[model samples]
Target chain A: MSNPESFRELCRKEIHTGPTSGVLPGYIQANLLILPKCVAESFEDLCTRNPVACPILSKTEGRPQFLRNHASLIKQGTFDIRTDFPRYNVYSRGKLVQQKNNCVNEWSSDHVGFLIGCSFTFEHALEKAGLVPKNVLYNKNVSMFRTTKFLDSAGIFHQCPYVVSMRPYKLTEVEIVREITRKFKKTHGEPLDWGYDGAKRLGI
Target chain B: MSNPESFRELCRKEIHTGPTSGVLPGYIQANLLILPKCVAESFEDLCTRNPVACPILSKTEGRPQFLRNHASLIKQGTFDIRTDFPRYNVYSRGKLVQQKNNCVNEWSSDHVGFLIGCSFTFEHALEKAGLVPKNVLYNKNVSMFRTTKFLDSAGIFHQCPYVVSMRPYKLTEVEIVREITRKFKKTHGEPLDWGYDGAKRLGI
Candidate 1:
């Protein structure tokens, strides 16, 4: 569990089938998305425009001859998209259809994969900065809420609201929090807005 | 040529099937994209993040049981995505398979559509401001070039470069051009950077 490569091997063999979060400390954990290439353009564009919300770390090569399953190189070793994830949620028409441990059946020549940056990376930095957010200190999941402030719509991803991961911090520590987070652009950098006015602006 | 409604009608009837650009002056023109809903999330995410290059104006509603063909209400009247575009290019695995006048044979219930903001809308405003871009003044198509500045990759749309539309302007007219485009947020607000230094920064 200490070594990410060995952990990934365990994931491939289905021996360690649980949430990968908090397991790989000191290493960057990525959020993965696998979908068909046809609809990927718009998604990539949206992520590029909204980096704070959706920062991309790595992605699979867009090749026409996706004849074979891809073995993506993460940090230490190659990880197959279909089998590497602890679990997979199959969404159909924006609804969850099924849950699977692996996606060997679902992944195809047309499918593409992306590795999005996780906020956990910055949380590590925040802890180092001594401005640890309330949720982290409490060892609780950062409370998330759907705000009225909608993101720019693209294709069928319309009416997509800005989902905020709330982590309360002292008023005195806000500037330090901003400074620490501002350094990590790939991770959600800096507070978009702070305080009650900020909350109102975000429509939280 | 004047009324957008009549123009759409002409497109539907296959009477005036040509480029829709420069025809409907003073009207907001949009770029269209149609794809399956299953892969739309990533595409939409990419578009949302990179608004300047990909300004999304409107989108089809994401719904389950997409049983029938959708007749979308555009600026003036209901225009079907299949027949309204004047032309359609069928791409499979990122390769052009064929060209069609309509997508009636191709479009299915799983497909989703998006209307992206076109630069032509701002061109109209720019002309009104008495500072026409070089492409418009000489009646030439805006020469667009791909820059080395890649966007934040999402899903399969990785290694996507920033394709810039080049237009020449005098040094004195730069700030005014910036001011003119600044007001149009939905249509690429202001210059990301300007001049040779700007071009260098964008990696042009």
Candidate 2:
């Protein structure tokens, strides 16, 4: 059996400090979103309203152990959610700035953790099906872009251009690609649009 | 906390003699196919080749533990491969005849168990995502039809039009339906084609 503790230890010591893509294999990986509890209910409502941007795998209130499904592997150390990730960008007034580990000390009890499904989960499923992922092989984060489309909004999470992660493949493999995409709704399942080129006006 | 043993007990007592559809929630229920050892390798090969059709969840040499993933559950009794399922049909010369349970005792030792992913997996996911499953609500088996598309074959599993199981929805819900379909690849991911009235072609 794959050891979850060792996996978490690798992350804790900064040993497995790379992007958590393709790490846990069949185990689900999730996106991290922390916000004050005042905004938590609103964000949860937002996710329910616009599931594409925020597919809630689990949510943590006051404590982080609520992510038991994914956090089951974090053996010895408590998940210092702020630092365990390879890198973190803090947003203040919607402006992102880099932050170091242990930012949890700054966290108040009013904070809530939203464990959203990430592309990593579906990407792993694709590789298991023998479909190669060019972005992962190239060792680059997926090509993410802010789109002109609007996502359903609730409270603080307002309607904005949907952000998308893209991967390119040959036309021959389109069937298999589409097949894999169909199974991962929580991870932004199917492409919003295919064969989109950079030169086309995005209308953003 | 669901019990796999309860399912075994039902099979043993002949109390639950029906398709094991939506029986156990949150557990991975599988499609069972047993083949002789001589043809097992080829069938396994076929499963790998056409993964969308035959996602081999767990293949046992001779009816190994079906609930290997659930260690905590109590195992009540042995699962008689020849009789455990609610119904059995025997194939001779590539033609299947409905048979009572245990008719295949003579062919038992020569058989190997192949558990493939079933649409039940994705149906669970869809229900979790709050998507309505029209077939379930209407009390019907999912609509299945033979497609003109050929699946990659192995040995006796010859090239034939893929048999796909489908559920329908209005045109307006297509995108949301596709999104839910993307998350469950083991369950035949997505539709190969849509809006084609397959039932009429099948003379159903």
Candidate topping lDDT: 1
Worst 10 residues of 2 chain B by lDDT: B195-204
lDDT of 2 by residue, B1-204 (tens): 157666766775677776665667666667778777998876775665556667778666444444344323435355555556666677777798666654455456667777788886667666776776777666567777775444443445544556778777776765566666655556665544345443433223
- Per-residue error for B188 in candidate 2, Å, reads 30
Quick one: best TM-score, which candidate?
1
Candidate 1 CAPRI assessment class: incorrect
The prediction achieving the highest DockQ against the true structure is: 1
Clashing pairs in 2: A182-B181, A182-B182, A183-B182, A183-B183, A183-B184, A184-B182, A184-B183
lDDT of 1 by residue, A87-134 (tens): 789988789999888888887878788777776777877777776766
Candidate RMSDs in order: 20.9, 12.2
